[model samples]
Target: MRRIVGADAVCALIAGALGYLVRFGPAGTDGQHVSLGVALALPLVWVAAMLVARSYEERFLWVGADEFRRVFFASALLLATVGTVSWAFKLDVARGFVVLALPLATLLTLGQRYAQRQWLHRRRRHGLFRQTTLLVGHRAGVESLHQQLEREAYHGYRVVGCALPGGRDVAAQFDGLPVLGDLDEVVDIVRGFEVDTVAVLPSPELDGPALRRLGWDLEDTRAELLLAPAVTEVAGPRVRIRPVAGLPLLHMERPELTGVRRLTKGAFDRTSAALGILFLAPVLLGIALAVKVTSHGPVFFRQERVGRDGRTFSMLKFRSMVVGADRMVDDLAEESDGNGVLFKKKDDPRVTRVGKVLRRYSLDELPQLINVVRGDMSLVGPRPPLQGEVERYGYDMHRRFLVKPGLTGLWQVSGRSDLSWDDSVRIDVRYVENWSLTFDFMILWKTAGAVLRGSGAY
Candidate 1:
């Protein structure tokens, strides 16, 4: 936290100096430039604004979009404050200065934060800077919690021991982690192992009184208490803890994916797609020509895909396969190594040399911009499913259809063709349940890296 704050202060100073230099170079011969005073004051004000906005809070740091969002809003608020102050004092504040400085500062701060997070993640991946967590619960719940924490190391939770309550004498290992002690001696185990956190999963043994007593016991130790609820894939924004009659009840708001928000999303998709087409017209034409010259099939591939509310739409893509590739499905069924529902072969023989390059970098999905403009798809959402795949969807999977299919989505950037059916469904459903413009922005931001890396792109 201290490092991040120091970096942010330095970035603010740099941004202010850069903005001043870019606008006015240096003070005039008569000392008429604004940079001298503004540059000196901007960094201090920027740091104050960030501290006041709680941008450096632990919960908002080094993960997800919350930190970025906070920084952006804080910067905007600072700009607003500057504008008001200038207006009220009738001072000459350069619009160019604010324009350049605010964005530059935000970008620099976010870059520094990302670099710091990468360094932290590298260490955490090797089991450094991570909290040594002691798991406490029934066997099944403890195991489930351990699996989740093990899968997501970025959370900085390293399970060092487990304490099962009222269980028989067990082996040394409990779900791969050591069984330190039973619930009766959780405090001793925590102190003995010098664990950082005692993560208590939902269990009958850890009642209100027991939890209160456990917290009291930990007052003298460095161990913090964390309760792991059973909720899965619910984002923090949706869940609120409300204490009703001394019982903490989890209140979740229903996701609003309709009305004005939906209309705004549609407008954004069409506008962005239209502008993208206008800008990328030449590249699109060049790709079309390349596909035409390289393959015997048509340049554009149009196929039926399930859209919002079970509507079928003609999804478009650049043809990356032969004319009768649909018919080739039967022959490739024996070699099918997809996630069961979707048919994807990372090294299918059907791909031509040019098609392979196009798919590798996801250039083939460019034509789906037309789908976005035509209202058949969004710029971001769940991946459009084929009719066959839709038929295989269970009740929970149908939730994806509440919004329009997207040209790019969580499934696309997460693992693409490499993701399992369950994983794909999990990501898509999470997006559907937690749809927001900011979430869309984050996905779009991540899509750039995913495309460049091409890890899971076929």
Candidate 2:
């Protein structure tokens, strides 16, 4: 499926580019052809959209809504550009032909994407084309890499464990695999692990010469060497690598927060929130009425939560449980799923009848957009831990305070109420450590689907 999408995309470009050339060639060469400018628009749009949507993340593709969405957006953008340019130049382009091509190209592109995904899925299941990685770095870094490989098994990278600095006393099982070796022993480790690739997760303090030497050493091994830059969760578009004389430097562009980006985000928040309220207003009203009528409590549950920069704000949600639910935390502590610090009950008696539906779909969180507009919270960010949760947090966990608590964050998207205290803290710390506008956008995008699926919601 991946190959088909890539091929179809390339074919679309060749076809579109060739079509343009044929149409515009000399005088009367090709009769009644679409204008060259219009013909070129199709492929250009596909390339641009593919780049933006990151369709090339993997080579062997499959059927995912993301694939189709990218194709549709690309097609739409291309046609829209064509229409605009035609109007501007007063070109005699047929609206019917342009309209007809949009859906045709989109369907073909989607079909190819689907076909490629199926092919890749089958190939992976048969172990025909699998990625074998030689992880190279410090013990901690290697251990982290090993765990990641184990977690995302479907991504198809099978780690034979890591190649550390020395063949020394690497624990018998680091993340349930023997440490193959260290940096000096990488070449030997690569062969022993039967790895086709090397991922360098070097110690943070690795000097330039050693770093360059690792790359040099991998040259003769006929294996791919990938530098797993300490940067994680930062989007690809925001990162740029530059090579100086015999030295490769990684330059990560700071996420833009001013001018058009700021404006776009602000506009997105306001417009989306406004429309959301419009569409969900009846539901919101109904929830509010239910809370008031059924429970002896306020319609909205307002709790003082830590926001951006550790500032305090009253976060709003539809009242799901009793008004004094906060007071029951101490008593309910023993009912938690995991750690004692964070309290949760699988089946709480305090929840109102309508609250279940509201909580399940995250409908209760709709009110937080008002907080977003008012600058008390962001649409996506770290979860706002309660003061008790914060007090219980280790030093490593306080990193979440660097940014405002989000309505939907890594914690919410990853597991929501099902997450343990440590897991919750880790997600927040990771978000704070690697927050970007693009990361936030991706989180927001995933959150929409996660909410609809209602996974782990309570």
Q: Evaluated with lDDT, which candidate comes out highest?
A: 1
Indicate the TM-score of model 2: 0.74
Q: Please write out the lDDT profile of model 2 over residues 109-189, one tens digit for every residue.
A: 776666666676567656656688877777778777776665445456777767655545756556666677656787787
RMSD of each: 3.1, 6.5
Per-residue lDDT over 1-458 for candidate 1, one digit per residue giving the tens place of the 0 to 100 score:
88888899999999988988887776533443554577778878888989888998986887777888888888989988888988899777688878998899999998998899889988887888888899899888888778778767877998888998653377578778778778889999887889899999888878889989999999999988988877767788998999999898999888879888889999999999999999999999999999999879799988999999999989888998888888899889877779888888878988888888889889999999999999999999999999999889998899999999998889877889988887888889999999989889889988998998998877
10 residues in a row with least lDDT, candidate 2: 57-66
Clashing pairs in 1: none
Model 1: residues with Cα > 4 Å off, grouped in runs:
19-38, 41-45, 72-103, 167-171
Error of 2 at 43 (Å): 10
- RMSD to the native, candidate 2? 6.5
**TM-scores of the models, in the order given:** 0.88, 0.74
lDDT of 2: 0.70
